[model samples]
Target: MLERLLDNPLQDPSGYRQRCFEVKQDAQTDKWWLYVTYCFPAEATARSRDTVVGVDVGVSVPLYAALSHGHARLGHQHFGPLGKQIRNLQNQVVARRRSIQRAGRRGVVDKTARAGHGVKRMLGGTEKLRGRIDRAYTTLNHQLSAAVIRFARNHGAGVIQVEDLSGLQESLRGTFLGGRWRYDQLQRFIEYKATEVGIEYRKVNPAYTSRRCSECGVIHEGFTQAFRDQHGTQGRSARFECPACGYQADADYNAARNLSLVDIEERIRVQCA
Candidate 1:
């Protein structure tokens, strides 16, 4: 379907061109919809320059991005009122489910049946809420990507270093920490936007990036309290410390530095190879 749509402009008999085309559909409410993008390239070029960006994904902010020009952009939309509403809805669903189960055990079928209906309604609402959250996240991810691209254009950067979040899933699975974080979707959006903007994006192993200090290369079990206090401690999903130097930054920044170092190493390796 996407391929057909992409080829539509070429198939036009009069040679008319379609510039902005989007595939979207109404899902539930009149205000809600789904968007499947098939953005066409305006031009083709292989000699485009690369821009380097470092991204840190978290549950609180979803994205903590640093461009190569020393400018940092934080994404806080994921932690706003919409997220709070989603949490509230989730709590209601859980309470309703529990109430239904209890009623079933007591042989009270009348209230239990109504409880089942309520659960269904809540589940339906939750699904719609999830779609809205997904849309918001998608928008935020693209904004971050565009910001990185703009920073690169302004600073003459050509390569971007992003942390590999593959293991995050395995680490969070089956825990209370699971389901709250949506790392995979955010990564996918970032990759797509990077490719669209012709930026060279690389993912490095995130192992110990948080625990290894960016300055002085000292490794610690956790970041010091002073370090946390300095960085405001709002988005420190990981921790690190450097005893040799009094360097203190968010664990995400340390990880970003690790990613940058890895990008440099890879470039050197490619040159050597």
Candidate 2:
């Protein structure tokens, strides 16, 4: 399978250039896998990247994107179902492992247990469990990132902006990737994919992005995730209400609109004034 994928056609007209190669060996089967990275010249667009699409990342929805200047928006319906499917897959794998561990601890698997090895090798080793989770996240990241890029391109957006990875530790406490590796992976995929089509990608400071209202620009200090918890609103349908202007919208969507602005701080100042 790897060979078939890596085999580049000899007379292919595609201008793909091989950039790098990576190889890894599976601990369970001792099988080796090869990964080849390729790059191609950027395809020019009719317009420059003057328009921007703001993307907000979160645990449930994964991504919420919108145009900087218009009413167009992309919500969970566009980029969230796959993430939930992948999360369910990871949960199933974890539940099976836990069942094995419990059985081993209760002496139910004494026949299959090896000395000093517990039941780590029963269903599959720890490595195998980790591999399944990793593969799930990798697929989720690629599909979600590709969807974001496609959304931007279809709307003629030249620039793609997302929040910088600060304070992500709090939001990702219970997540599988712990917010670091997975967040970076998704960001990098979007950036590289955007670059392939002459689109500019940027990570902007995320300060007050969630609190600031996209409708009125008022920074509601109380509009945090904790507030959502109190209101019993979560997931893709989470709501954000502005106390100042009585504006209400999906929490992630409001944040995404704020991120789409060129100068978030300046816009806040002007609106607040």
Q: By lDDT, who's the top model here?
A: 2
As for candidate 2, its clashing pairs are: none
Candidate 1's displacement at residue 271, Å, is 22
lDDT of 2 by residue, 76-113 (tens): 67755676676686676667668667756645536543
**Model 2, TM vs. native:** 0.80
TM-score of each model, in listed order:
0.59, 0.80
| Residue 53 accuracy (lDDT) in model 1 | 58
Q: Model 1, which residues run further than 4 Å from truth?
A: 1-51, 58-61, 67-119, 170-179, 222-241, 263-273
Q: After superposition, how far is residue 8 of candidate 2 from its true place, in Å?
A: 8.1
| TM-score leader | 2
